[model samples]
Target: MGKFGIAFTIAILMVACKEDPSAKEESKQGFRMTDEERNATPQVQKQPEKNFRTFTNLADTTFIRLADFSDGFAYDLRYATENNFLKEKVYDCAECYTRVKTAKALLMANKEFEKYGVRIKFFDCYRPNSVQYKMWAIVPNPQYVANPKKGSIHNKGGAVDITLETLDGKELDMGTDFDFFGKRAYHDMTELPRKILENRKLLKETMEKHGFWSTRTEWWHYNLSGAHKDKVANFKWECE
Candidate 1:
């Protein structure tokens, strides 16, 4: 073949070898699109593989990272930083873990919350018993922090501290921040603005419908029914 002909053939082969962008998008969203549609739609960047873990064959009481099972939820994880009520960084890394049963309940509750245009945004979940001690040392008040010797439902992997946020990540007004430790944060606090009360009611009622109950004093805290029966656990997650 002449040099011109050989160069033309090589260019065609290179084009055929290139990966299809639509195929990558299809794998991420589980929907296929034609070339024209792909060109018109905006691209969504994929999150890291750590968020895609599965729960196959996992036991109901076994602890699993919540992010691995769903992308619909958001996390703030205040204890991983010094921003919490304790004003101390108690965790080496920010991670949300819960028992399989509790995670299942949360997934269902979040779906319901989505109908109202909001979803669960977690502050804490499945805290280690060791970390509970750190919190107790700072704020020994049982009204604020559970006694480490008694071990809270969080240590049992059945409780979560969460709030609601819009699908686009705007936080719903729930009257007070996480761990406010005041009457203003109470579930029975009705003196707040109409919007704040409604937001708290939505969170509390939906969680109860999913077999979780809220403490009267903490609007952001929820415990799965009977989760306190589970033993206190000191299982710590590995930090990268």
Candidate 2:
């Protein structure tokens, strides 16, 4: 009786030691990696650095040029026009460049405005870090330039300065000029003419809905969110 009991106990123990067939198969199929094994695996390399050129805004001078789109405005209009604006600003962040594309999309979205002949007029876009440094050196105004250490959103290629005009080409009186830096540009609902103020509101609301935000000091300035927040290599785009 003792020998048989011992034999039966040994057989039961062997059966218990055997792994479940389904679990064994699953363990073979599932992902398994030791820390060293994971460390040994080569990680994907990042994309090669983008080649970029340098471009300086001519308006950086005292003789303010009305950007190309500011047709009637006496300011020198060099990069202000549609044809030249994008190339005017350097593309520091490939991702942030979507702001320009979004602006164009906004224009196309308002097709009815096209019938009325109205369109967005850009004053500036994508300023290079060097140009920003130059501007800061000249003015050194915090109101205009964020600390170079913190960097301007423009430096990241995520901000734009723009205005609106009629299809027949009448510029909406924005209560203040593009670079004006006072209370007038504050999006004051009570100060401007109902129509003009309403126009400002429209521009702000439209741009905000499209992932862009306006600064309090400059109604025309809008920064696209999550675009190129890092300091890119300082380079300019050359005219073709």
Q: Quick one: how many clashes does candidate 2 have?
A: 15
Model 1 residue pairs with clashes: none
lDDT minimum window of 10 residues, candidate 1: 47-56
lDDT of 1 by residue, 1-240 (tens): 999999999999999999898788878989986779868968799886654766689999999988879999999999999998788999999999999999999999999999999999999999999999988988898887889999999999999999999999999999888988789998888999999998998999899999999999999999999999999999999998
True-structure lDDT of candidate 2: 0.58
Q: Pick the candidate with the highest lDDT.
A: 1
**Candidate 2 vs. true structure, TM-score:** 0.55
Error of 1 at 196 (Å): 0.8
